[model samples]
Target chain A: MTLTPILAMRWWLPQDAALHGAALDREMYLALWIMTGLLATAHLVMLVGLCIGRREAKRSIWRLEVAPLLLLTILFGWMTIRAERLWAATRYAGADPAVMQVEVVGAQFVWYFRYPGADARFGKTKPELVQPGEGNPLGIDPGDEDGRDDRVSSELVLPIGREVDLRIRSLDVIHGFSVPEMRVKQNAIPGQVFHIHFTPVHEGRYAVLCTQVCGLGHYRMQAAVRVVSIAEFARWSER
Target chain B: MKIFSTHHRTIGIGYLLLAGTSVAIGTLLSLLMRVHRVWPDLNWPLWGVIKPEDYLAAVTMHGTLMVFFVLTTAPQSGFSNLVLPEQIGSRTMALPWLNAAGLWTTVASLLVLLSAFFVRGGGPISGWTSYPPLSALAEAGPGQATGMDLWLVSIGLFCIASTMNGANTLVTVIRCRCKGMTWGRMPLTVWAWLTAALLTVIVFSVLFAAALMLLCDWHAGTSFFVPAGGVINGVVDTQHGDGSPLLWLHLFWFFGHPEVYIAILPGMGMTSMLLANFCRRGIPAYRWMITTTLLIGLLGLSVWGHHMFVAGLNPWAGTVFQLTTIAIAIPSTAKVLNWLMTLWGSRPTYSTPMLWSLGFVSLFIAGGVTGPVLAQPALDAYLHNTFFVVAHFHLVMAMAGVFSIFAGLTYWFPLIAGRRLD
Candidate 1:
């Protein structure tokens, strides 16, 4: 079966609103690329050093050994300090005070998403009430008043240019929640609620695949993500 | 003690040879998976390419062998089995028979591990954690039947070997210091090994306990990790509802986290000593370096919660575990700086061993930088399971740890075999 395309046409690789977040990804990638280049360069220098500095009858292998060591230390220290700054900016940027909070529950194979109702509150849905096949025991709980206006869907949707807060959890086993375009991923563990904040700058669709092997259906545990224009999202939600 | 005894040197050489073999095998397995990802159309007559069942088995073998066979044993047991006693000036390893037992048992474990391939079902797919329900039942994956049973047994045997080797190291270090080598004068490598062995005492005991419990669930009928009402594959799991699966997690990580250090702390100590010696200067902050080594070991225990932060653990638990995990960086960073400073303003020796040591520091810094980031309760909520995690772990767990072990082997080849190996 031919699946839909994943890489969408874009002016930039990571088209996201959080400017710091976008920059962090590019910087880190470039830093690693440079590191790799420098490493190969050093290896070449070592080869030359071996030829010149070896205990050969014609050569001394010991010229300037200390200098290279110092250079390596400099490279290492610079990378560490640079990495520290990026790590802080990419992962810990403040979350917007106003954003949609969605609770995502992943069990054995499928993912369930619950939207806070008009009350902006998630009603209780007991694990026992969950049953497979017959509307899913993990389905929405209509008993609670707040469950009435809340929307439930297997697909995840976020408004472009708006921050979205994901409260991720797994009802059974471990499942990884990942958005390739966003470069965001976190493990959904039982009894754990992981949170992530990201603002989509491009209006496009992406796939969320489970990176962790939770079970047999793990390979097929795929979710479609729709990053819609703000008006389009509002129109869809209003429906 | 004897200016590099022939026997000690030979033992060191043996470690290099064995570790090399495991690395070769494990690396091949990894490449198989990577290539398979690129070429799913693989077909090898009798051995079909990349079946779902095969992926699980390979994953199981990859993790099992790498973690126990290569990563755990190579550095701590294989190296310490040969080096620590010598480094401490002991004439022979403590309980020499037990020492041999460690090797044989490890061999036996590898045999049993590899034997899973020929078994009816293949190997268990339930990640290395092998949580119950999936791990407790014999029908979870292709090899869930007899193969999983052997997997448990192999691991059990491996744990026994580790305990023996750990005991030997602890005893030799305590009882056999060479003349004038006080605890103060002991090489940092010796300190790291002793500290790692002490940590292993807890690590092996818990894994052994968990293994025995798993055996009981798989064979004799117990529900250590399964839920009673849960039916796996249409058949109700035997005696399920009564077991507390999380107990295994608690016990496993208790040893698992320290086991992480058991893999790295030695490299840290080795790096420290090598840099100091190669630089032809005394290691600055000798007291602080030793203190930090000990602290890295002690603080490692408190950070297990970092693994469970998102497991619906108390939010407050997140704060505590994060603090404990991040606290480790203070001393760890100190060690990194110490290495950099040791080489400052001095002529240094450049050899294959030195190359590996420098690489270790680089990778350690690269990976260790992210440890604190992932430790943040809030931040880990995002970066915990991505390729980012994969990168960090690969850097430290295999790259730094395995590379340093490689360095040790190359550096000490003359001592072991009397001929330098490039």
Candidate 2:
């Protein structure tokens, strides 16, 4: 990557993901604005100070106190307040009870997505039958009628404009399912399930990268996700 | 006095060399672990020659060497061991022998940890966390042999060494300042070091006790953490009925979380000082910045429950842990803003130190942003053990911390050596 001139588009990519409008986005939104103001004001001051604050034959002993204390108190003090507010919001992000639940199973080098069958309950699954067939290990049990209605997609595809409540787990090591466009990410651990919620607003495809390093072949372990309309998703998932 | 004279720089240089060498080694291990996952068949993996049992042994050893011997001992302890006294308007901290003992005890700890590699099972694979059931049972893996015992012994020794070092630092900062060096006027770096020492005094000693209990179970046929019905590799293992595996999590994280701040606070403190001095201006909100660091440390101690949210504890434990973890962000955000504020309206230098500080901010933000997601028990249930965590920790523990250490060494090199290596 070649270094661009200062006039070029700043290297920072703006926050635009769907999840960005909430929790962290609001904080970064304020942060970006404060940063811009601070930068401009500081530059103006530095240039002005160099030109005017120098000795230029003026006799004065520099007395430094109080101004710094008060200024820092306000600046950092404000930061603390903003952060505390965001910190609270980041946790208590209450979800509507009507949200749909999806189970995300993470294993060494692979991901399993299980959507409860038409009954809205997870169907029976046996770990022994899981034989990495068609690249889907931890096979969906064909013996149970619930398995027939239960949808097991090789990859994650969500309907646009619908809330998704995620239940994630790992069969072995720790892993994380991450989608940058959604600005959403979370971990998947063994013998324990973790959950988070997000609603995608746009209809498009995005890369789903594994953010945790869970042993060898970690980089090669990646998949793509597509977001489509509810009707389109129903037709695709119904198969 | 003779050793501290003209050759003073060698001590610091030697410290850097040792630290840099271990970092290089650990980095290689991490990279290789990445590679092994990416291409499991790679025959040339640096520590890849070991079998399943030995592979795990290496895992435990790798974390011990990296976090304790390399990260903890180097920048704050080793760097200050050489430079802080001189910079603080004194010859050195009081009780130089104890300081020397702390260093050697650490070296001894490293020796014991490394020796696990040559034991019967090669090394410990139970992970650096060394969770019980896996660690408590000998049949769990090959390193569970005498190797596991040595790993505990080394950590116990490290606790002693760290406690001693922390005490030395605290006493020196409080008692030995020169006439011109008042408490408020003392460098923020000194404040950070003293605070870290106080934390170690409270946290590391608890670890020392945990290590003793674990050691007793490993040898004296007693079970402090190993629970009943525990079967490793089909062998019935012996463990006391009273001790719970969760105790290790309680003991370790109590020390572990603060231990992380101990790594970061000094680096952030260095950022405050170098940026303040380099900008040719007094630090912005210097007092507030100092107080924010102390606040972060205090908040850091209370947040250990965050790591144990999934440990199947009290039903309400996750909620409490989640809240406390979120609460820590306030002080941290205050820290982030103060650093950038100090650079405002000043004659900023593009020195290597300054560059690393800039890099530090970016990495800290990157690593810290994911913290909230993990704090939620429901959220972490999915994200645990995933690549996202790799991204988070490497950003904070390895990447950001490494950048700060790099900047610190380079900035202090001139002061430590009198002749610039650059």
Candidate 3:
């Protein structure tokens, strides 16, 4: 039996479904345990001191102050290095060149996903041509040959086991694109394209939430991300 | 007219009362948001079926008021005015007129902020961080047009007021100390106010400039924060030229992170003073305590990028900020250790103020332990903008500030009101 569900019962974090998520969860748990132990010890010391009233003051400043502080410095220094390395594993390193590419666009209150069709390249988009009512929400330019085969969908469909590189941006304001199950969160800023890569290890559907408060519809701003078998994803993309 | 009196004590009481009212309204707004969040369909007589924009407006106003009017003012402007001069053996602040001016400007800023709700689109939904082009463009959202302008203007006025207050604190602490009250001999509370004032003088001015830049972007068609954006609300943003949203993040967080120190340092000082007094012993290693206080203030200004780690900040820059944030934890840890050491092995009085100090210590530790966790960019990747960040700040900054405020009120009630409340 896996310990993840049992851990989830008490950790209160969402189920980890991404490959990088387990390490992230491990780092988080380690930090939490260290902090919890320190917190309890500090409180216990305070309680003991308060109860043990009027004892002669010990002149050992080094024992009392310097040693503890030095220990904390070293401990936290180690944790910081570990956490930064883990974070850099995704952000500082580039994804494989052969990985799948998807353009994720965030509007006022919606999330739109686009796939580079047969051309395997995204079509150029213009802000002016964006009219969701006109059946073109991402504003695919008509003149660009790469634009013709681009497929736009409200939901994101991914093939399991493939590393997907997401080029995320917003049409208006700043919106946070967060999928908790994937342990992915990045701001979709206007005039900026942030590329984040992650691999899915599970085939279940997950909720894509807008973490940044966008507008009146922000609460309901969500989409579905369905991870499917490679064969199923191939058939779906072709359609 | 009485509220306009220039007496530092009266002005201090005015600040305390103002913060009291603000905390009331701010707490009510938060409660409304919380209830609405849990029961999205829950309807109240005053605010029926809270919309997302309404919820967001509450968020913006709640943060602005709690951070500025309550946390910033109560500890430094309110409690310090009541006790700072007395503790440092000064008859009055170095610049009384400036203190009075700061108070009046703050009052005006509060009025203007409240006026945003009555305007066309209600309060701006952008959070107190107020990252633009959401805060810059007029047609970005329901409250982006007129409401945001008022928000900027109000914040500008607050920046000016805080700058004035900081100046007065610095001048009083530096110049007005009575004879024989040397720097080392000065109370920790005075040192806290001095360092916090120094931070305020520097950072609030930067925030003022940032607010002005955003205002220009809004009406003057300047592209300070709004980039050559392709579109907002289906309208091509042609009026604005090249600008980066990251510029706003840099300027804002530059002020924003230090603003946290500005709010909490005075509380930390008060905790030190109270713990020593109630514990029937002086705080051990007073010099180190002062050094940590100043170190926290100094290091706070360098760690703003930690707020932007996942906001597209370069990975290398994020690592630098991560290191600085962890460095800050060293001083914070030493400070906590100092508090615990002071309380050790002494017959402590459990008076109301003592309880408040102890409570502040508890909250501070609970809130602070999470600092290193969130400071790491890896953890922040998933935790930034989440409720975890919210709880961290609330525990460490906001609620702890409130606790310190109460500690001051209980301890200094006789000084302010000529009678103890408890």
The C-alpha RMSD in Å for every predicted model, in order, reads 7.0, 7.6, 2.8
Reference-based lDDT, residue B9, model 2: 38
Candidate order by DockQ, highest to lowest?
Answer: 3, 1, 2
Candidates ranked by TM-score: 3, 1, 2
The predicted structure with the larger lDDT, 2 or 3, is 3
Pick the winner on lDDT between candidates 1 and 3: 3
The parts of candidate 3 lying over 4 Å away from their true place are A1-11
Model 1's CAPRI class is: incorrect
Question: Model 1, range B1-422, lDDT digits (tens) per residue?
Answer: 33223343344444455566767777887888888887888885788767876776777788777777787777776677666766778787766667766776877888898888898877777767676555666655567778888988998998898888788788888888879879998888888888898888767888999999979877677767654444334333435456655666677777778888998998898888887777666777777778888998899777787776545455566666766775676777667756755554444678788888878877787777667556655445445555667787788898999778878877766666668785
Candidate 3 local lDDT, B141-185, one digit each (tens): 888878999999999999999999999999999999999999999
| CA shift of B288, model 2, Å | 0.4
Highest DockQ model number: 3
DockQ of each: 0.11, 0.07, 0.72
The per-residue C-alpha lDDT of model 1 at residue B233 equals 40
Q: What DockQ score does model 1 reach against the true complex?
A: 0.11
lDDT tens digits by residue: candidate 3, A42-94: 99999998888587646577889989999999999899889888988878987
lDDT for model 2, please.
0.67
What is the two-chain DockQ of model 2? Answer: 0.07
The numbered model that scores best in lDDT is 3
